[model samples]
Target: MSKRRLMNTAVATAALAFLGACTSMAPKYERPAAPVAAAFPDAAASGVPSAPATDIDWQAYFADARLKQLIDIALKNNRDLRVAVLNIEAARATYQIRRADLFPTVNVGMNLQRQNYDVKELYTVGASVSGYELDLWGRVRSLSDVALANYLGTEEARKSVQMSLISQVAQLYYTMLGDEAALKVTRETLTTREDSFKLTKLKFDNGAASELDFRQSESLLENARASHALQTRLRAQDENALALLLGQGVPSDLPGGLELTGQGLVAELPAGVPSEVLARRPDVRQAEQQLIAANANIGAARAAFFPRITLTANGGTASTELSGLFKSGTGVWSFTPSITLPIFDAGRNQANLDVAKVNREIAVAQYEKAIQTAFREVADALAGRANLDEQARATAAATASEEARFKLADLRYRNGASSYLDVLDAQRSLYTAQLALVQVQTAQVQNRVALYKALGGGWTEPKAQ
Candidate 1:
């Protein structure tokens, strides 16, 4: 064959070979299917609220000044949250490394060496060259895809941690409020019981009341005082907890007591749809990103079975004498194109493929479990909100009734128509009812916070896509 025709044929054969090599392994990325629940579990089908968008605007959701401040501080200063942010940065760095592997590496080095020949061989001062390979059965690219997905998953995890921190700080702050309010109630009851005890003792000394009645009043007074002391300790512990969350010393500057004036139940829980919940919840999204990464890995492991093609170049000088090292004859260059094919490794490839498949399945299960857990949490919050609302309402009504009954009993005892025990019983029942009402109010507030957390409201929305 003539030289031009032979060259043309060779070029055509090389192009076909390259194309054939490229076609053997392909992308195998399919998102795993997720199960769909009709609505949140135990939710009444007929009364189910319409789903809202999963993406909520945080600035609009929490309008309270105190709540917003606590969230901001937790985001900025919480140690765990800061660590989570660092984890995201580290993952991003890992992705960059994986991506850089796709291109050949060129390195330049200066070398000086001396060796003396025993007799037959030349003494040498020598240098050689080397570069790395990217044999694209897309191993590097597929691995990069895995790193990319992992980076994204870490970002979602950071969000999940941030949301949890914000909610926990707010929840603890509210708890501190409740403890303060409860302690105040106990102290006031202590004072009231103290005065009653003093008056009963006076009445007994003057013969207007019996010794037994006086002792009973003293007993009640001591019990209330004891409860007040316990409440004081509880309030201190909650304050310390709040301080630790804020990453500071527990300020001794807590309020002397709390007074509940307008503090009460929220008007209603802003209900949204289940679909929105999936989108808004961070743990769910984090799990899904993990699954995506695992799926990408399957492509990577599968690609490993194909032949790896690499092109390398080495250019440097070697000579027995240092002065002659760079001379034309001493400087040598070479190009090597090589392929590494797997013949057999006793099922290692198959085992890797199987492992990748199994991991994908595991990721699918984790994703499903996350969704299920999210659903359960939302359902629990909804039920708790409703039940606490009813409880507060009922408790408030009973408190009023008990207050009225105690007053009637007091009037009858003063007019000498009722026994001293009746007055004692009435006072104890009244105190218990009022205390229960306070407890219910605190519970209602906590329930609102839980519902906010359950609905995934505390998270800062990711910057617009």
Candidate 2:
């Protein structure tokens, strides 16, 4: 046969082989149905119209200027968030690399040879494709799909990290405010105790009051002083914790915090339908992406049982003299094809397929767990919602009544209408009630923050232009 006819045959053979091997062995993918309630408890049972938390804008949801500023700093500087962003870049790069494998790589090169047995030198210039694997069984495509899924998973993971960071900053910021408010209460109490101690000491000096009365006043003053010192340390510790969350020093320019009563978060956020959790929660979406990657891996494992085809081809001109390398009629070409069939693998392929199946099952479980955890969190937050306001109101009333009782007892003691023991008891009750009131206020505010986060209300997606 003529050289031209042989070249034509080789080209046609390669084309036919390429066209024949294009079928995929991977199973079709269908998202697993969410395995939880169709709607949140009260909203479902009572048919209440609930607003979706996912639709709320985060800045509007928080509504605190200092908190928004802190969240900005955290998104910029938190180490975990930075790592998550980097992971996305890495996963995307890996997917690109795997995708490139589906096509042949062509390279150009030059070579010169000197024979040891002969005194002549030969030169060759060529274009070649080296060991290009043909993805006839969709093996490369399946692997590329896996990498793509993982890349998407990484993106969702970054979003999950962002949401968590914002929630943490809000919680820590509120805690610091509570600590500062508690410290203020202690300082004011200390000042009142100091004035009372001075009066009692003067009465004792004048022999108008007994040593027991004077010592009792001194005891109350000392207790206030100790409490003041303790609260001061606690407030400082809270500030330090805020610094850590900010990933830098707390800004001196930060706006004064809202009183627990003034934190602008709504008392309750509507928990939307439970089925929406699959689409709204970042962790759940990440788990689903992971499941997709595992399912793709099963296709790659199945492809392993078929033959892998590869081709290595080179075309160039050869000459006895370096100057004649590209001369006509000096052309040379070759095509080499190879096929690998796995006859025996000690059950490695079967094991790989099994592992992929098991991983997919595990991912399904994780996905379900994420929904269950989110459901429980929202339910717990809502459980506190219906009662916290009433609790805080009752505690405040108790505090006010105790303050009145203490004032009346102090007046009666000075008038000799009651013993100092009654005054001491009233003072103790008033102090306890005051502290309890502060705690209830803190709880009412913190519970709102918790509900906002549980409902996935703190992270907003940028509007599409």
Candidate 3:
């Protein structure tokens, strides 16, 4: 055959082989059935219904301006979240490298040499493709797919981190508000007790009140002092925790914040079907991506059982003299195509395939567990929503009743109708009731934040135009 016809035939053969490389051995992926209940257990019991948390933006869900600012700061400055973002960048770069392997790498170069027996120099210039695998069994492509899945999983992980951070900041901020309220109540109680103690001491000195009355008043005064100190310490510790979540000290210029009782968070977020809610959760999506990567790895392992083909080619001009390197008569070209067929490996490929299959099984388990976990969280949050409102109302009523009882007891003691002991007991009861009310209100608001997070509400932000 003529040289031109031979070259044409070679090109056609290469084109056909390249086309054949598109076949993938990976199993077709179907999402596994959700391993939880069809709907949340508490969804039906909590008859109150509202918008799904997924549709509510966090900025709108949390009514407190200060809390929104704190969330913004945590998203930007938290160290754990920063690490998650960096991991995404790193995974993207790794995926880019894997994708680059699909294409040939061409390089241009020059080589110079001199013969021992001759004064003339040999020169060559060429552009060559070296050791480019033809991917006949889709090994490289499968690996690329694995990398892409991993990259996507990393992105989902970042979203999960952001959602958790938002929830944590809001919860901690609410807790701090509770602490402050409790501390204020304690300080007021302490001031009143101190005044009562001084009045009792003056009456005892004038021989108008008995020694027992003075001693009881002194005991109450000391107890109030201790309670005030305890509350002060608790409030300071709460502020420290809030600062840690904020990733810095609490800003002095923060916007006005709602009291724990006044934090009007969206209380009645809808809990959709388990499948729908789990699909939106970032951790669950991350797990599914991991399962996809494992499936792709099985394809790569299976492909290893087949032959690998590689091509190395160079086209250039060579001349004994440097000036003639590009001359038409000096033109030279070479093609080297090779095949590697596994023959004597001691079951290494089979072991790899087995390992890949086992890894895929593990990934399947993990994905299902993620779904189960998401369902449990949403269910727990829904239960909290159904019950916390009543708990808060009951606590508030108890606090009010204690307040009225304390006032009546103090009035009776001043009129000589009841002993100071009755007044002291009522005062203590009122203080305990007040603290309980603050705690229940804090929990009420925190439960709302939890529902928002469990339903995958906080990770999304509007993209800039």
Candidates' RMSD to native: 5.9, 3.4, 2.6
TM-score (C-alpha, index-matched) for candidate 2: 0.89
Local accuracy by lDDT, each model: 0.69, 0.80, 0.86
Model 2, range 1-465, lDDT digits (tens) per residue? Answer: 235754674576567446634767778888787777777664332335345666776676777888888888888888889999999999999999998887667788888888977747888877677787778778888899999999999998998888888888887877777778788888888887788788788889999889999999899989988988998998888888777877899888977556767887765466766777546787777888898888889889999999988888777778888878767667777789899999999999999999988988898788778878888887777777767778989999999999999899989988989887788888878888888888888888778777777777666764455
Say which prediction, candidate 1 or candidate 2, comes out ahead on lDDT.
2
Clashing pairs in 1: 51-273, 52-273
In candidate 1, which residue ranges exceed 4 Å CA deviation? 1-36, 41-59, 109-131, 250-270, 315-332, 461-465
What candidate 2 gets wrong by more than 4 Å, as runs, is 1-22, 42-51, 117-119, 321-323, 461-465
Worst 10 residues of 1 by lDDT: 120-129
Error of 1 at 244 (Å): 2.4
- lDDT per residue for candidate 3 within 165-231, as digits (tens), equals 9999998888889889988999999998988888788879998788998998899889888988998
Q: What is the lDDT of residue 48 in candidate 1?
A: 38
Better of 1 and 3 by lDDT: 3
TM-score of each: 0.80, 0.89, 0.93
